[model samples]
Target: MPLSVDRLKTLLQDDIKDLTKLSEILNKERTALKERSNTAIQTLASEKSTCIKSIEYRAKEKAKMFVDAGYQIKKGEFEKAIAEIQDPSLQALWRKVNIGLRFCQDQNTINGKVVSHSLKRVNKLMDIVRGQHNKPNLYGSSGKENSFGGLNSIAKA
Candidate 1:
């Protein structure tokens, strides 16, 4: 069965709503990471997962609609199909959803970087507390092992 234009619009609008929520969650997650709030991070992680699942489900439904309408799901295929409908409102909604998703993706990338840096710091601290003398082998511009300027271990530094 061919999917109606109304169904396409609904999916796009739903994606816009969920993507907006996901973007907010990602921003909160970045703040939580900076504040080192474990509880808030955990809560936001769950919320983010749920929001992502909903977005994926909607995307699959939209793809199914395209396939049923005899169009191959590819880049620009959705816009092409929407153009055929000739409804400016639906096209606007599609653009909004696309922009929202891209924003969310950028936010998520930033949050991941924050988490990675935090983990590296925590690991370094852990090595320090454990009294492990694992000096970071940083090379200077001269291609030589840079000394720690007379510091014996991480604890002394």
Candidate 2:
């Protein structure tokens, strides 16, 4: 038997709630990243992973339901499914869920960029600190820019 409209509605509502929570977590993670708190970032990353898994599981369930019902899941398919209820109120509620998801996706992209930039900087610093950097930037006493290739000692430069 196909999934019931009420069940789908409930699932979508639950997903919206979960995504809202994920958005809050992402905000906290941004704060952690800004503070450079390694411990907080680690803990928040674990929590975020768990939350993402839950969201993906629910989304897969919804997709399977749609497929089983002879519907091809795609953009706007979920909204169409909800529209079948023919109730403006129900349609609006589910649309809110989709809109919330889209917002979350955009925020996630921004957070990911922040994380990537931070990691790249850390790697560059690590190279310099380890004396493995071939082109370490330095300012001379004349205030001219220079790159030290193999001089690991700052005092000798």
Candidate 3:
């Protein structure tokens, strides 16, 4: 059976709400990461994972509905399809969803970079205390990262 456009719009609105929540969580995660609060980070990670799972589930359902509507499209393409619909209200809703999705993407990327940079700092510190080369990397089994050797025992540092 073909899905109703109204239902699709409703789904998009729900997705926008989910994305907004995820964006907020990502902002909180950034603060926690900057503060080096491991406990807060663990809590934020759990919350973020739950939000992602829910978002994925809803997106899959939305994609399936789009397929049933006669145009097989990815979740993002569903927004494109919605934009072409004749109803202005649906288009407005789709616009909100699109903007919300974009914000979520930007925030997520920022959070990922922050996490990566923090990891590199930790690796650099470990290298320093272990009397290894002052490089930032967790892996040494591969390539130039293994240029220096760490003390066999951390206690010797």
Per-residue alpha-carbon lDDT of model 2 for 49-140, expressed as tens digits?
Answer: 99889888888888887888877878887667667768776677677877888888888888888888898789789988999846766888
| Ranked candidates, highest lDDT first | 1, 2, 3
TM-score of each: 0.82, 0.73, 0.78
Number of clashes in every candidate structure? 0, 0, 0
Worst 10 residues of 1 by lDDT: 148-157
As a whole number from 0 to 100, the lDDT of residue 126 in candidate 2 is 92
Alpha-carbon error at 64 in model 1, in Å? 0.5
lDDT string for model 1 (1-157, tens) is 7767898888888898899899889989999999999999999999999999999999899899889989997888777888888788988998898889888888998999898888778987998899988776677899866545446575543
Q: Which number leads on TM-score?
A: 1
Off by over 4 Å in 3: 74-80, 135-157
Of the two candidates 2 and 3, the one with more favorable lDDT, higher being better, is 2
Residue pairs with colliding backbones in model 1 are none
| Global local distance difference test of model 3 | 0.80
Top of the candidates by lDDT: 1
Every model: Cα RMSD to truth: 6.9, 8.7, 6.7
